[model samples]
Target: MNTTHTSRHRGNDTGTGATTDRTNPPMTRRLSRLVPALCGLLLVLVGVTACGRTESSGATTTDATTTGSELSYEAVGACKDVFSRTDAPGAQIIVLWDSTASVADMPFPAALAEDLKTASLDDGTLSVIAVDGEAVAPRILAKDVALSTTGERDRPSVAKLAEVIPACVQSVYLNGLVPTAPGTDLHRAMTVAAEIAEPGATVWTVSDMMSTSGQLALSKAVLAEPADQAAETAAADAPVDLHRNVWKVSGMANAATPLLSASREWVRDFTRGLCRGWNASGCKSIELDPVNPVRTATGLPKDPVPPFPAVDAVTTATTCSFTLPDELLFDGGSAELRGDVDEVLNQPLALLDANAETTLRIVGHAASSGAYTAAELLALSKARVQAVRDRIVAAGIEKARVSSRGVGDTEPLAEDIDPSTGLQIPEIAAAERRVELIIEGAPCSR
Candidate 1:
C-alpha cells in the first residue's frame, strides 16, 4: 500500500526540452505546458510536406489506404520514404510457427510487432502478415490502414502499426483446422505477400526457416520469373532491389523445454542477425546501437534520440536474475526510461513465461535525496512505484496478482552518487527511485 517512487531529472543535451520529474506536481504541471510546445515544435520541424504527386499508375496498389488509418499520413509518408529508399516498398512481415506449438511457445509475433512499431521511416509504408498452413493463398489475418504523415496515435492506430503475432489464429490452424482450404503453403504465402506489395516492395518472411514439402516450391516461386517476359519485367522493375527482405525466425523449438537454456543463445543470435540483416538490406531498421558522438562532429544533423522506457528488474528463481545495466537507467534525477529497457525487459518476460510456476511481485523504492522533504519524497516514491506497476500490468501481467509496495530510502542498491557527474556522492540516495520485483507463488496458470 505504501510505496516510494524516487526519480531524478537530467538535462537533455540536444536542447529539445528539459526532462520532466516523474513525481513532482509542479514539474508535471510545468511539463504539461512545455510538452505541447515541444511536440508542436517537433511537428513543425519534421512536419510532412508533399514531396511529389502520386498519380494512379498502372502498378497494382493494394488499396492499403485502409491500413494507413492507424498512422498519420505524415508518419506513414515518412515511413514510406524511408522504406522506399531502402528498396523496401510496401513491406510485409510474416511470422511462422509450428502447427503444434502452444501460444506461449511462440513469441516471434510479439517481438516482431514491437520491433515494427519502433521502426523509423522518413516516408514509406509497412505491413505485417502471419501464416500457418499449406494454403497456397494466404489471407490477410489482420490489416491496418496504410499510415501517412498526419494520423492520431490511438490504440487501433498503434495496434495497426504494430505487428501482432497471430497466436489465436495459429492455435486454430495447428489443431488440424486449416484457415485456408489447401492447407498452409509457405511458398504461396510468400508469393501472395510479394505480389500484393507495391512493385519492388520488401517482403520479410519470419518463420523457423524450416520447410517440409513446400520449401522448394516457395523458393522456386520466390526465384521464378516468366522466361519470355522475365527480361522485360526485370527491366521495368529494375530499381527494385532483387534481394528480398526474407528473415527466417527459428528457435521456437528451444522454448519447449523449461529452462530455455538452448533457446537463449539462439534468440540472441537470431534477433541480432535479423536486425543486422534488416539494416544491411536497406529495410529502414531501428537503430539499436548507442548514438555515436562522432556523427555530430561530422556536422550532420544529430538523429533525435528518443527517450527509453524505464524497466524494473525482475528476479526469477530458476534462471539468472537479470537487472538492467545501469547505463539503461535515467541519468541523475531523471525518471524517464531509456531505450535499452526494451531489450532488458523483453527477454525476461519471455523467460518468465517459459518457466511455469514463476510468480512475480513488484516493489517500488525511492531514494530520498536532493531538494525534497521526507513527505514529498514519500509521495514521489509512491508515484514512481505505481508507474512501474502500471507498465508491468500493461505488458500482460494480471494486475490482481501483482502487488506494489513503496519503501522510501530504506535500502540502497548502489552508493548514492550523481548519475551525471559521478563526482557528487550523496551517501545512498541514488538507489531510492528503483522499482524491484520479486517472483512469488507460481507463474499464473496459463
Candidate 2:
C-alpha cells in the first residue's frame, strides 16, 4: 500500500558571521521528535504490507493495494475461527468456484474466503480455482503458510492471509458478474480438484450443479431419472480419481425449469454418487440452497399495469379448486370471457397438467340482485360456464375430461342476507359471483 507523505522545510539563516539564537532547539531534541515520526510511518507500512515477510513459514505476502476488492470486516469476524480449530490443520484444501452467471445471488465465494483464514496450515497448501466452460489454472493463494501459534507472528500472518484470500475470492465473484463463460463445467472442475488432492485433502466444490454444455450436460431427462441411475450416468460422463480424499459440495442451487424439491433431491443424490465413486472414501458434506428469488422473475405487476390480488388454488387429497372472480373473467352482464383471463387461468391449468388422469369441472354462479328473472339468470350462468370450459379444452385438456354446470343464484359462497334486517349485503353477494374449476384426481400437493 502506498502512503502519501507531506514535508515542510524550516530554514535557519546560513549567512556569513550569522549565529544561532539560544532559543533554538538542540540536536538531541530534534532527533527525538524525528524518531516518533519515523516509528509512526513504520507502523503504517507494517499494517499495509503484512510486516514485509514471515520468518518461520517463508510465506509470500501480496500487496493488498493491488487488489480491487477486500472482504468486509463483519465477514472476517464471523468466519475467522471456522477452520482454525478443526482436528486436522495439516490437511490440504482446494476450493473450486462456479464462475458463471448462476452466481448472481450466491455467497459461497465470500464465505469460503472468510473460512480459509483459520483453515490454513503451516505445512499445507491452499488453492482456489474458477470453474467455467473452459479449464483454467488454479490460483495458489497460500503455500505452506499458517497463522502463527505465537503472538509475535500472528498479527502479520493474519494480515497477509486477509489480503490474498479475499483478493482471489473477489476475482471469482467479479467473473460471475460479467460472465464470459458460456456454460458450467462442474464435472471437469471437480475432476481437476480431485487430481490435485492428496489422500486426506478436502476438495470443496461450490456450484449450482447444472452443467449446460459439457460431457455431463444436464437436462430434464437426467433429472427425472432415479437417484442411483442418475449418479451412474454422471460418473460415466467424466470419471474422476478422488484418491480417497473427501469431497464437499456446497450451495447447489435450484434450476428454473424443475420444481424446487425435485431439483434439490436430484442434485443431492447425484453429488453423493460422484463423491462415493472413483475411489473416494465417501461424500463428506453437501448443502442444497434455494436459488435466490432475485435471480428469477416474480411475475409481479409492473408500473403500466395496475396491481391486483394474487390468485391461489385450494387442494385436497383428491380435488383442487381455483376460484376466478366473475369480474376478472367476464365483464358485467356478459358471458364472453375477457381477453386478459389467460394469465389468471394458467394457475389452475398447471395443477391440472401435473396429474394426467385429472378431470376438470367448470361451475358458474350468479348474484341474485333482482336484475334478471330466474330463467334469465340460469341461462346466463350456463353460458358463462360454457365459455370457461371452452378455454380449458383449448388449452389441450381432452373434451371428454372436462364437464360444465351452472347453479345460477341458488348456491352462494357467502351469506347474501343480513339476519338483523333481511337486507342484502352487496359485498357478500359479489363474493358468490365466480367461476370455480373443480379438478378431480389431481395431486393434493405439488
Candidate 3:
C-alpha cells in the first residue's frame, strides 16, 4: 500500500505547505488480507457515535495570551526541555485520513492521532480533526475549550470533541475505500483548522503526503489572495488576523502501516526546535539568557552558557555574511518563520546586483531554546538555508556562485531577550538564517 500526505494553509495569505511520500516493502504482505478485520477493530475502538452541535455560539473569544516579557534564553531552553519530555503539554493533533482506495485499511492515521492525543502537553490543550477519504471535506473529530484563566479544563468542549471523533472515524469506515485521489486537499483542511484554532495554537498533521493534487491544493492555499477585499464588503468585519503553527509527520512507508514510532520522533524534534526560538523559516536563532538584574548587581557569573557552534561555512569559496532580520528571525517559542521571506532576501540580492564576481552563500541556522536535539536542529537549519538558496537562484542569481549551508544552533547575535519585546529572550538564534554574498574577484560589468 502507498500513501501520500500534504498540509498547507488556506483562506489566508500565509502561504506554507509540506508534503511527504514513503515507499517500502510490505511488512504484512499476508496482513494485506487482514486489513478488513484490523480496520474494523480500529473503527470500533476510535469511532464516533454522535455529532455534537456545531460550536456556533458562545465560543469564547478571548485574546491569545502573550507573555509580555521577552523570551529569555533561559525560557527558551526551559521550553525545549518541556517539549522533549513525554510529560510535555498535549498539542491539538489533527488527522486527515485519505478515504482513497490506496489507503482504505491504513490504521496508521488513527494510531498516530491517538498517540498524539495521549502525549503530554502539561497545561496544553489537545484537539483532533479527522476526515474520511470519501468525504469532499474534512470533519471535526475533537477539540477542547480554550485553556481557561483559572486553569480548569473545559470538560464540555473536550467531551464534545470526544463524541465527534468516533463518528468521524466511522464515517471514514462506512465510506469504504473510494479510490484515494492522487492527492488529498490537506491545505484546505489545515486552513480550516487554523481558522478554528485559537491564536498561538500548535498543529500536528499525520498523513502519507502522497498526492500531487494535495500538494497543489496546499500551495494554492498558502498563496491565496488576502481576504481584505471580502472583509471590506462586510460592514461589521473587523480586519481578519491569521496565525498558525504546523508540524508535519512524514516518512511512513505506507498509509496502512503504523508509523507512529517514526512520526512521534519527528514531532518531538520539530516541537523542540520550534519552542526554542527556531524562526518561521525553520532556522534557529542565537538566543541569549536574560541578564538577571540581581545576579548582575551581585557580580555573579551569568548562568552557564551553552557553547554554540560557529555558523560560518565555506560554500563554493564564497565568504558571505549570513544574518536574519531581527523581527522575522525568531518568534517566541516557535520555529515557523515569520514575514515574507522572499521579500527579505530581495534586500540583500539587490545589493549584489548582477556582478559576475559576486558569489552568494546562503547559510541556514537553527537556534535553540534548548529544545532541539542536534540532529533535529541540523535538519531545520539546512532546510531553511536551502529554501533561501533556491529562491535566490530562481530570482536569477548564478547557480555557480550560489550555495547553501546549515549551521545548527552555533552562533549568537544579541542578548536572548528579544530586543523588540522586553521579556526574557530566547538565545539570539535568528542570526543563523542568513545569506552571505562574497564578492569573488571583482564586479563584472554587464
Candidate 4:
C-alpha cells in the first residue's frame, strides 16, 4: 500500500530507485457486461460472481465479456472489488501478529485493514503468523485469490477486500494469545516474519515495533549504532537477515519506546532510520506514534487529492486506452525512454498496422505519492507521452498523425477506495500511472 517504493515494481532494477511493474494490478474495476460465447460464458463467470452483492431479481448478475486469453467472472470474497490483468502468478502474503499485546490494548488501524483487502483481490494466498515466541506455524487466512486481470473494478462480485484483509488480521489479534513470552519481543517476532517473507510477498505487521526482550532494546547509544556493529553485537538476535524483504513491507510502523522519553524527536528519527535500514521495497516510514502503521492503501500514500471516482469516458472499439507503466517505458524521476520500448509496444504495433491513418494521442499519468509534486508529475506524464509519440512517428506513422499530453493526476489515474478502509484495488491505482493511447476513428482493418 505504501507508494514510497511502488516504483520498484514492473521489473525495474532496484539500483535505479523504485520503478514499476505490470504483474499485479487494480483500479476502480466494474463489470462491462461481459457476454462471451456460451462456452466462454461459463468459463469467465467464475471470476465475477459476487459474494453478498445482489441484483434486481435478488440474484447476482451473471454478465461479462471474455476476449483473448481473458476470462471475466466474479468471486464472492470476504470483501472484494473489480480488477483486470493478463494471466500471471498469484500473490503470497504473510500476516504477522504482535502477540505481546492484547487486541483491546493494541487495536489494529483501520487504514491497514484496507491494505489487506486490496492485496487479497490479487491472485494469491494469505498466511497468518503469531509472533508470541511460542513457535506457532503460519496459518492460511485466505487462499485462491481472485484477480480482475481484465482491469475492471465495478463488478458487483468485487467484495470490499479492503475490509476483509484487515479483518483477518484483527481475528488473529483478538483470538491469538501469548501463553509464554518474556515480553513484547518485536525483534524476534519480526525476524520470524522476515524469514518467511519472499521478495514478492506483501507483509503486514501489527505491533508497536517495540522490542521488550531478545535482541533490540531501547538505548540512547542506538543512534550512533552502525548497521554492521549493531548487527554483530546488539542486534545479533534482531532481524538483520531479513532486511531485503523487510524493505518492502507495509502497515503501521511505530512502536512504544519509553527509552526515547529524554528526546521525543529521536523516537521518530531512529524509527525512520530503522525502516530505511530495512530498505523497504514499498513505502518507508518509522513513526514514533504509539501505533506507527505502515501500509500504502492500495499502493498510494494517502493523498489529499480526491480520487477519480467516476468510471472513465467509456472506451469504444475505435477509441480506447492502452496502459503502459511510466517506469517501464522510462527510468524513474526522468522521462528518458528505454531502448526496449519496441517490446512494450507489441499491442501498439498491431493497432498501428490496422489504423495506419488514424491519430494516436498518448496521455502520460503519474500516481500521488512522495515521489513528486502535482506539477512535476504532470510534466513527467507529458514528457513520457512526447517521448512515445516521437517513437511512433519515427516508425513510419506520420508525425502529424500522433500527439502527446500529460494529464497529471487530474484524471482517473488512481483507483477509488472504499471510504471506510482507504483501500482501492491495486490494478486500478497502477492503471493511473501510465501512457494511454487514445486512437482515432472507427473499427480498424481486420
Candidate 5:
C-alpha cells in the first residue's frame, strides 16, 4: 500500500543524503569531475590519504572493535539503529503509545530508554502517536534529529548518541503522558502508523495490545474464538497494507493485574494475526522492556478484576448448569470463596432473578487424590458449595430457593491415579475439583 503522511510536522532532513530524482544531471557531472581535483589537492595537503576520500565519504562503516576506542557503544544507539537504518532514506520511527486505561497503571518501559540511548538516528525522524482512541493522529517527537556525530568532518571516533536520542524520546514521551484514555483500538493505531509512516519506517506499538473497545475491541468473547478466526475477524475492521514497513508490539500481557495465561496466549495470537492483516514486513510482539522501578503500574483501576475465566456450561430447555473449576473460587484445601466469587456469581444470580420460579442447586466436587482423607475431602466439598449457596442467597435470592450438596471424588473427568505409580496426576486432579451451579425450571441465556 502507498504510504500517506498526514503530519505537517514531519521534517525532511536533506543533509543526510541525495534524493533519488536526478534534477540536474549536467551540473552533477561537472561536480563529479571536479571531485578528483579536490581529492588530489586534499591528498597533497594532508600528505597521506586515499584518492577515493574514504574518510569524508559520509558513510561511517560500523566496526565492533572501534566502538570502544573510536566510539562508545551504547544500548540506546543500537535500538535507534534498529529503526533508523542509515541507508533507508526518508525512514521514520513511529511509537504507537498506548495510554488506554488498561495500561494506565503500568510504568513506562525502562529498557526502552536504554535501547534508545544506544541508537544513532542520524537523519531519521522519531514520531509518537497516542493509541488513545480509534481516531488519534501521529505527532512529531524528534523531527529530523541527528542522533550521531561521529567520524572526521563527522569526527565521531569518540562520539555517542547516549544522550541526544534518548533525551528526545524521554521528552516527547513524558510530555505526552497525560491522564489515561479508555479504549485501546490497536487496529486503528496501526492504521495511523501506516498513514504517518514513511516507506521502510518501523512502527513500535507500546501497549498491552488489548483492544478493549471499539470495532476492534478484543472482548473475552471475541478472544475465545479460535486464534486465526479471532484475528481475521478483528483485522476485517481496519486492514492496513504496510508495503515495506515493520511492526513490533511490546508491553503485551502486562498490566497492574497479571492477566490469565489463556488471556495472554489469545492476545498474542490475535496480535500476531492483526500484524499479518497489516501485512508488515516483520512482526514482533510480547517483547516488553525491563520494568522501570520508578514507573510501576500504580494507576490501575481500583480493585481491578480480570475477565472471568471460561467455565463449561450445560443447558437444556429448562435446566442449566455451569461448571466452575475449583481453582477459580477457592484456594487449595480451603473452603472459603475467593474474593472475586461475587463477580463470578453475577450471571447465575441474574438468571435466578429473571426466572422467579427457578431453584438453584449447588454441587461441589473434590479431586480423588490423596490430598485429604475421604471424610475431609467430602467435608471440604460440602463447605465449598455451601459457600456458593450462601453468596447467592446473600444476593437477595430466597435462602429456601437454594440447596447445596457435595459429591466427593465420585465423578472424575480423567483418571485421578496413574496405574503405574499410583500417584495422582496434578492436572487431572485439579480438573476434577470443580463446583457446579445447577439452575432448575429456567433456561440459561449464557
Candidate 6:
C-alpha cells in the first residue's frame, strides 16, 4: 500500500532523475522510455467474471474467457468505463501506456478518467504508467507514478488528476523524456508490470502488439516452427507475478487474417503465459477506433488523466517483519485463495516451522467506507486474517500458537486522513486495508 501523490496534476510533473541517450541528437529516435504503473480492485466484491460491461460506443461488450495454458480475452476496458460519471469502491486501475509507434493515436484515457472520477472510491487506487521508446532496448523509467489512495476530499481533484490521461501519456514527448532507441521494449514493459503492478488490478495497455524489443526480435529464425519465440521470450521476462483484467487498446493483430492472427496469438500467448507465471488472473484485449499513431511531441493525445503510477517501494528491512498486500494472497474483496497463495505462503510457513520459538502475529485490516458497511468491513477484515491463520493451521502450525486479529481501518500503511477534517482523504484511503504478519523473536539473533 502507498500514499497519494503531493500534486494531483501528475500529467504536468517533469518527473525526477531523467536519463537520456549519451548522444541527444536532433530528430532523435522515435520514443524514449516506458512506464507501466499498477492499480487493481482493492476488494473483489463485484467479481470480474460478471459480464455485460458498457463500452464507449454506448454498446454492451462482454468478455470471453479462455481455458488451457494459453491467453484469451477476459475483460475489455471499454468507452463506458472512461465516460462513466462515478467510480465504484475498490476500483483499482493500472495503465500500460504504449508510446510505441502504432498505439499513440487512440483517445481512451479520457474515458478512463471519467470512470475514475465517477468512482465512489473509499479506498481504491489509480495508476497511469507510460512506456516509450528509449536508447537501451529495455529502457524503462519509473516516472509519473500517480497513486491516489491518500483520500482526497475534493472529488473533482481526483477526477482532474485522471482527466490528464493524455497529458500523462504526452508528458514523455512534451518533456523530451522518451529516447530515440531503435526498438520498443513492449515485452520488458509488460514483463515489469507483472512484477511490480498492484496484483489483480485492471491493466489497460495501449500498444500495437509489436514486441520489437531487441531482446526478442520477431524474425523468421526467432519465430520458427520447432521453437516458439513468444514462449522463449516469456520464459526470459515473465515475472513471478502478472496482469489483471487486461484491456488492450488499438492493436492491429487480427484473428481472421493468417499472418496477423499468428502474430496476435504469439502476443496473446506470450502475455497470458507471462501473467500466468506471475500467477495473475483474467485478461482481455479491447478494440477502439483506428487512431493514427502519434510520433511528434505536439501530437500527444489529451484527456482526463487519473493518478499516474506509484513510485517504487522503499522498504526498510531493518526489522524481521513482513507485510503482504491482500491482493497477493486473495481476491480483492473476498478471502478466496488465489492458486499461488499457498505457494507463496509456504516460504513463510517453513520459516515459522523452522523457528517454533518465534511468535507470529497476524493483523487484518480494511479500508473504510465505500459500498461495505462498517460492521461488514470489520468482518471481512477478520475473515481475511483468519483465512491466513487457517492456512497456517492447515499446514500443521498450532492454531493457538499463532495470534490473529482483524484490525479494521485502524492501521494504515499510507496516511489517508487529514487532521483538519478528521475524515478520510478519499484519494489514498484504500491503502489502509491490508494484512500484516509481525514476527517477534528476541531470543533468535540474525
Candidate maximizing TM-score: 5
TM-scores for candidates 1 onward, in order: 0.26, 0.45, 0.26, 0.38, 0.48, 0.35
| Distance from true location, Cα of 442 in model 6, Å | 89
**112, model 1: CA deviation in Å?**
34
Better of 4 and 6 by TM-score: 4
C-alpha positional error of residue 147 in candidate 2 after TM-score superposition, expressed in Å: 8.8
Ordering by lDDT: 5, 2, 4, 6, 3, 1
Score residue 367 of candidate 1 by CA lDDT. 53
Tens digits of per-residue lDDT for model 3, 30-71: 222222222232234445343222122322221111132122
For all predictions, the C-alpha RMSD in Å is 26.2, 22.5, 24.5, 24.8, 16.5, 24.8
Candidate 2 lowest-lDDT run of ten: 300-309
Pick the winner on lDDT between candidates 3 and 4: 4
**For each candidate, what is the lDDT?**
0.36, 0.56, 0.37, 0.46, 0.58, 0.45
- Candidate no. 5 TM-score: 0.48
Shift in Å, residue 48, candidate 2: 15
User: Top lDDT: which candidate number?
Assistant: 5
Ranking by TM-score: 5, 2, 4, 6, 1, 3
Candidate 2 structure quality by residue, lDDT tens digits, 1-446: 22222111111212332232312335224323322222223233345422444433444433222222433333232223222222223446777766455443455455565555445323234555666663433333322222212122143444444434444344433333322345666777667677667667767777667666566666544543445676787787678888887666666744433333434555677778776666576475565655554354233111110112234578887898888767567644699887767866887788777788989889889877655787788889999999989998899888998999998988887777678977656556656778888889974476
Better TM-score candidate (2, 4): 2
Q: Against the correct fold, how does model 6 do in TM-score?
A: 0.35
Candidate 4 lDDT over residue span 1-446, tens digit each: 32211222222112343333332332222232221122123334335333432321233434335443233322222123322221224455566665443221345555455545566454344445555422333332333233322222333333433333343334323343442533444465556566656566766666544434445554323422332343344433344444445332222223232222212333334444555455454434434445343333232111121111111233577775566665356654578877656756656656776776667777787765444678887887788888888888777778777777888888874453446776543445545667777777734333
User: Is 1 or 5 the stronger prediction by TM-score?
Assistant: 5
Off by over 4 Å in 5: 1-91, 104-122, 134-154, 179-181, 284-446
- Deviation of model 2 at 196, angstroms: 1.5
Candidate 2 clash figure, as a count: 0
- How far residue 228's Cα lies from its native spot in candidate 4, in Å, is 11
